[model samples]
Target: MRVSPINAACCVLLVALLGAASGAQATSIYRTTDAQGNVVFTDNPERGGEEVELNPLTVVPSGQRAPAPQSRPEASASPSSPSQAVSSPFMPYSTFRIAAPRNEETLQTGEAGNLQVELGIEPALREDHRVRLLVDGAVSQSAMHSDVFMLGNLERGERVLQAELLDASGEVRHRSAPVTLYVQRASVNLPQNPNNPN
Candidate 1:
């Protein structure tokens, strides 16, 4: 029952998000352990885990995030609510967004979910700022000082990604427009799959 830091962090992120997004009825969040021994959280009870009841969670529109075509962000940042990430009066960035994994790119069924993401931030990110990746609306991991993110373990399916810049205070200084990526895995039912009996 060992949990990696990344999984632990993901658990925390899910809890934080569920708490912030819950309402009067309170959406239910289920915690489960994946085959890899990684802790996973989801809304599906069928996935199976203890039900966690918490306050309503509001989805953080950590978007308005993105970058220019060739530019990139500077480095190092952390998490805070979108409320805390209000547009600053010092909005100096002209462009920012995910540059790699081009929108609609597809990963072959044989490939693992490893993703190498690049940011296009104009004027270079400010020295006082840090950048983070948002996968499907949730912060992928803590902000860092580099423009490049080597991300792995992406689930098989459609994934939306964005990059956000944070001020020293941890506000959402800037976010890149989201890029969509699909990770395909061989399905037994697929006609092209050798395992397909049909």
Candidate 2:
């Protein structure tokens, strides 16, 4: 049977619509590295490359209702009274110790006679806490937050050093083990001339 021109045109339109619909679907893409280490991408499955599956994009039309947001469980309510808040005590400084210039260590002093002090604190120091360096049983340096300190003009003798962690109220919260060290300084004594009169 001879096809009519109108029927032939309808058949062509149907085939075009099917082709367009198929083209809208995502096609598998393959990626591979060549011998020269160059990356190549292709949609041909015969290329012997791993296939990459792409997810279809979803677009929401305007004036349409969107999915409702999920609801999350609320956190437990906080204490309403100050008495409940004070029931727990704050413990700070799990470990504090002097790291540098070990006990009974002898340090050689330079012309300026400067000594460096370092501390080892676990979990680091908090903002509300300050470090104090004790030299010979006194507060030689106080209100320090840094872990390292540079001390100058140390006398030539055995010296004791300690570190204390203080709170905002200047109360000592933790004390490190005392470290003893001797500073060796050059003798300033000059030889007197025998002919010189006293």
- How accurate locally, in lDDT, is each candidate? 0.77, 0.70
On residues 1-198, what C-alpha lDDT tens digit does candidate 2 reach at each position? 345577557545644444344446655666565675545555667887876554454445789977978899799887645443223223655567899978898877443357889998877888878888898989886578888988878888989998877778887766778899888765545225332235
Worst 10 residues of 1 by lDDT: 81-90
Per-residue lDDT of 192 in model 2: 53
For all predicted structures, in order, the TM-scores are: 0.49, 0.48
Taking the tens digit of each residue's C-alpha lDDT, what string does model 1 give over 1-198? 999998899799888866666654567888888888888888778888988767544443566645546856777576655644443223676667778989999976656678899987777878888999988999889889888998777888999988878889987776676788998765756778653356
lDDT of 2 at 88: 28
Q: Highest TM-score among the candidates is held by which one? A: 1
